[model samples]
Target: MESETIQEPLDRFLVSVERKAFVMARMATRDTDEALDIVQDAMQALVEKYAGRPEAEWPPVFYRILNNRIRDWHRRQKIRNLWRGWLKPWSESNDRNDDPLEQIQDPGVVDPGEGMDRKASMARLEVALANLPLRQREAFLLRAWNGLDVASTAVAMGCSVGSVKTHYSRAIHTLRQFLEEYRP
Candidate 1:
């Protein structure tokens, strides 16, 4: 009974962040299935390893687990691709339907013009973010999108505060340059 009380907040927190975390993972990996797997693994790791920790510590710890899982996935992919490179004749082409990140047009907006324009701008920003270097993207998303402070983001990224600042600053500058014409 007491354990449930302790777990309730953690459960709520996980629910709150799950979708954003999956989107972040998807954006980083560009592979929907792998991103889903990574998020699941991160959540499991957080539950198993850090569930007993204070709630205040949960966000950074969970994000750190997520970032580490993403790195591990990328590392495994690099090795697999290397082996595939040596045995290229058996390679199969990917089907287009497997992508889960495709943006769907919404039908429920009250103001179609405003909603369409907003969606278009958001799509462009998403593309620009996906094109950013990994560290820069991570910094920007953690600080701006996920709303983590510099110290917390540093903890999550396993980097120093100065590095977070530098990465975040560079990311903002790059986005401004890339999306200069996206202003409403």
Candidate 2:
């Protein structure tokens, strides 16, 4: 009975965070499967390692685990890319046909133009986000998208609050420049 009480709020918390965490991971990885795997790993790590902590502490802890997982994934990718580059002469061309946009569902709106505009705007925002440096992107997503405050974002990012502010500011400036043409 005590275990059930503990598990219920944890489950709710995970559910509430799942989609945004997946989006954050997806933006970082640019691959759906990798993003899903990272989010799952983060969730499992949180449950296994931090379940006993106070509920108020969960967000920063969970995000910290998630960011660590993302960083590790990037490190592994870099190593893999290095090996692939070395083996390039013997390997076939690495062409991928998967278009991330194709996976988006129709909004089912009455006005076709509205949906198209929304998609175009989203595409522009995504491009801007993808162009940011990893640290900047992480700061922006954690602070702006995830709604984590500066101190919590610093904790999640494993960085100082000043660093988070600088990264997030740079990310916002860069994004604004990139998407300036789309502004109304």
Candidate 3:
């Protein structure tokens, strides 16, 4: 008697994790459309690389690949910036004519029910977050937002547990300082 090996379980696991994976990519890129593309690419790579592996290995394997892809994307962006700097025209004006206030307004603040209405307050927090180095943001999001354990976050980040702890601690401290200053 021949028993068929079931692939259904692996397919189900992929489906379950896909949405969260997309959300993670979106946070890293801060763009929904780009995140969707990254997720699709990650899914295809996972199917090609790990679909034949044991179901137990799929989660970490898929995330490792996705993280590597995101890192590669960042590296390419940096290289492109360097090239743009070399090739950019000198004719462009350094002076800005646009109103800084227009760019500074937070739509989220307009609804006081949603949150505080202090424009400078929200801007301070956002600027603080943007200023954080990438690893810190990644660590904070993985641990605090995504609710991953330290060990799992370490695996996803391809870093030591201690490194993850350091990044998370710095991110939390920075965020706390920024938020405390803005507290109503």
Candidate 4:
């Protein structure tokens, strides 16, 4: 009874973030259904494992759970691909036209007073971000998109400050390179 009282706020917090968490997971997985499953898994894992932790700690803890699930999914996909590759070595050839940039089309609908040039810039930035390495992508999103500070990012990623710094620096450099090449 006391535990449920303590966990009610955490439950509310998770509910508030559920939609955005699904969006983030979808972007990470590029699969809507898989993303939904990941979000559900993350929420369940949080409730079961960390429900008693202080409220101040839930954000990073929630993200850590979500991140681990995503990584596990990616790993399983990798193994599946490896087996599929052995069965069909021509699978890579079938995907020759699936350029990442082509998939990043902006809908071209903008709010009043928003400039086309700025929209173009944002679309280009999204492409660059999509091309980032997985760890770098996660670090950038957790820090910039989610607005978590370095310490929180470190907690979420299960890494030291230095590794986060390295990943972030590399992400910035790679994004700059992509922007220069595409000039969008």
Candidate 5:
């Protein structure tokens, strides 16, 4: 019975976070498969390692684990790219033809034109976010998208509060500049 009590909230928390976490990971990785794997790994790590913590502490702990996983993925990609460069220097191509925007849909929307406008705006935002430096992007997403406070964001990012503030401020400025034309 006691175990059931503990498991219930954790299950609820995971379910609540899963979609947002997947979106965050997808934005960071720009690869659907990689993002799914990262979110799954983060969820597993949180359940295995931090399940005993108070519910109030779960957000920071889970996000910290998720961000760490994303960072590790970036590191691994860098190493792979380095080796691939050495092995096939001439074949390197940065072009990606897939349009991720086409995959996004909102079935609940009643108007197709409004939905297209929304999707276009979201695509521009995503591109601006993708262009941000990793630390700035992490800070922005954790604070803005995840609704985490400054201290919680600091904890999630494994950075000082001041660093989180600085990164987030820079991210906001850069994003505002990038999306200026889209503004009404």
Candidate 6:
């Protein structure tokens, strides 16, 4: 049998969970490149901020950074969309207008409807997850997918445990509603 020993436990821990984190990021962002970027940002944050902390605490801290980055990413997207919407009415003229804001596409954003390659169940689950409210998705994905405890989920989400529980409950309820007809 070949031994697969990672040098440090921290390295091993990060290696073990990185793929899941990427998946979580992908599910949140709905863009592979953006998801990869988010995961990279999260890794940088984890290394910078939490490297000195205990290894066991890394999960919560890493996810907290990741969740925060995801929030920031969404915020940036909203702002960009808002600007684009506001500018669209003015920029329809024949006058040449070159603005850097217009030139700057949101980083790592892929074209929409580019995920047609996913298998049926994965695609359905992606839609259901996407339909979830941000907080509900955060709660469910953190608690259910990441295997974080309620307290850890709260910490990652920057909310109270009660809020986490509420979001998770509502997420479960909503998901059941969404997927009820698809039961096999």
Q: Which number leads on lDDT?
A: 5
Largest TM-score belongs to which candidate? 4
What's model 3's lDDT at 16? 84
Screening candidate 5 with a backbone cut-off below 3 angstroms (N, C-alpha, C), the clashing residue pairs are: none
TM-score of 6: 0.76
Deviation (Å) of 114 in candidate 4:
7.1
Give the per-residue lDDT of model 6 (tens digit) for 1-184: 1122322765777898799889888878878999999999988778766777777788888888888988999999999878987879676544765532233223342433444323433445567887678889989998998889999888889989999999999999988776664433
Superposed by TM-score, candidate 5 places the C-alpha of residue 51 at a distance from the truth, in angstroms, of 0.5
- The order by descending lDDT is 5, 2, 1, 4, 6, 3
The sequence of per-residue lDDT tens digits that candidate 2 reaches over residues 1-184 is 8667779999999999999989988988989999999999999999988988999899999999998999999999999988998978565544643453444445355457767677666777886786678899999998998899999999999999999999999999988886676553
lDDT digits (tens) for residues 85-144 of candidate 3: 789856354565453234444556354653555556666655565556778877886787
lDDT of 5 by residue, 1-184 (tens): 8567789999999998999899888888889999999999999999888898899999998999999999999999999989999999786375654453344344345557877676666767787887688899999999999999999999999989999999999999998886786553
The candidate with the higher TM-score, 4 or 6, is 4
lDDT by residue for model 1 (24-109), tens: 99988989999999999999999888888889889988988999998888789889999887889555645444332354334356
Each model's C-alpha lDDT?
0.85, 0.86, 0.73, 0.83, 0.87, 0.77
* Cα error of candidate 5 at position 123, Å: 1.7
**Better-scoring candidate (lDDT), 1 or 4:** 1
**Model 4 off-target regions past 4 Å?**
109-114
Model 5 alpha-carbon drift over 4 Å, by segment: 94-119, 181-184
Better candidate number, 1 or 2, judged by TM-score: 2
Superposed Cα deviation of residue 125, candidate 1 (Å): 1.0
Q: Per-residue lDDT for 143 in model 3?
A: 83
Q: What is the lDDT of residue 93 in candidate 1?
A: 42
